[model samples]
Target: YILRGWIEDRSADEARGLDRAGWATALTDPAVGTALEAVHDEPGRAWTVEELGARGGLSRSAFARRFTALVGMPPLTYLTWWRMTSAGRLLLSGDAPLSAVAQQVGYVSEFAFAKAFKREYGIAPGRYRRVENARAAS
Candidate 1:
């Protein structure tokens, strides 16, 4: 719904040559795109730079350099960003427990996930879920 609308809007902007940066631009490269797609499609996978580089058919150093150059961030950084983004969406859209959300985003431990989520979002995951749900209700 909202996510689809946002994607369509971004696609429309790109179609009009708005020159936006980030994943849309980074995905134009074949090698980087392959690696990025893998990360996006299976964000819960325990990924390593070596594995991602292999998916891109490049040496680890080469893939890292190209991904960083095009994406404006390191690959793992983007992975974390995507994971947190996914978790946030799940939190907003459902009544899943925090542990489930944590596992879905690749965190095996609720404590660790909460710490990472808090670091990224500046609020703990449970509180974030509650606040966002309350705001949506209002």
Candidate 2:
């Protein structure tokens, strides 16, 4: 229930932002919102368009089109971005091993996780963590 409140709060914030663009009512759209919630609630899951579309009660192609139009990326692309960001937060804030962090963010291999992390953040996860730790200490 606490997580659901946070999600609702974020949607309200997004709606406020959208008000400036004349689309505030889009916050009421269940399809895109449901798909987003599924992704955010389970970033560690192996998410696919078909699965997400099913969650939204949308056809695969329709969900892809609508999600991209509303969320600014295809479902899978957003999933990767979300996973990377979630992993980056873990790297910054915790002492968890890189392998464990990878698993938490749905990567099975540390090497793949490192590669993706570097691709997204422009630095390896270990180095990024060290830098963040240093910053926190200072």
Candidate 3:
């Protein structure tokens, strides 16, 4: 309920004219925020440090340093985390097959996708979906 309320409040804030930049004001570094936006916008893309750094107009080393300092992890680590998170969201909200979801989240192989998904969520993708569906129904 608390998480739901926070999502609602953030939606309300957007409705009241807060843009993405406004929403990201809590982040200290604009460059880090830029990198975040890039990753969120294209979690399926095969992103590299050089590419993300270029998006933020910083050199690779500087971008990695600032991103780790501000975001608490390296950029690629965050990218993989986001990919898994996006895949989980797709699982809950859509009827796409596991293979399709895996591809959409940047995995070419369903086995690899399932392995990573289990690593993150502690359940296989199908089981995770079933559990979340049951919870929602209840």
lDDT of each: 0.81, 0.76, 0.77
Global fold similarity of model 1 (TM-score): 0.85
Per-residue lDDT for 59 in model 3? Answer: 94
Top candidate (TM-score) = 1
**How many residue pairs clash (N, CA or C atoms closer than 3 angstroms) in each of the candidate models, in the order given?**
0, 0, 0
Best by lDDT: 1
**Candidate 1's residue-wise lDDT over 1-138, tens digit each?**
423633744665455444347656677788888887787778789999889999878999999998888876788987887788778888988999999999999999999989989987899999999999999899
Q: In model 3, which runs have C-alpha deviations exceeding 4 angstroms?
A: 1-28
Q: What is the TM-score (0 to 1) of candidate 2?
A: 0.80
The clash tally of candidate 3 reads 0
lDDT of 2: 0.76
Write model 3 residue lDDT over 13-58, tens digit each, in one string.
4554444453344154678777777777778888899988887799
User: TM-score, each model?
Assistant: 0.85, 0.80, 0.79
Instruction: Please identify which of the two predictions, 1 or 2, would achieve the higher TM-score against the true structure.
Output: 1
Q: Who is ahead in TM-score, 2 or 3?
A: 2
lDDT of 1: 0.81
Question: lDDT by residue for model 2 over 7-123, one digit each (tens)?
Answer: 544564465342222222223468877877777778899988998888879999998887777765677976887788788778877899999999998999999999999997789
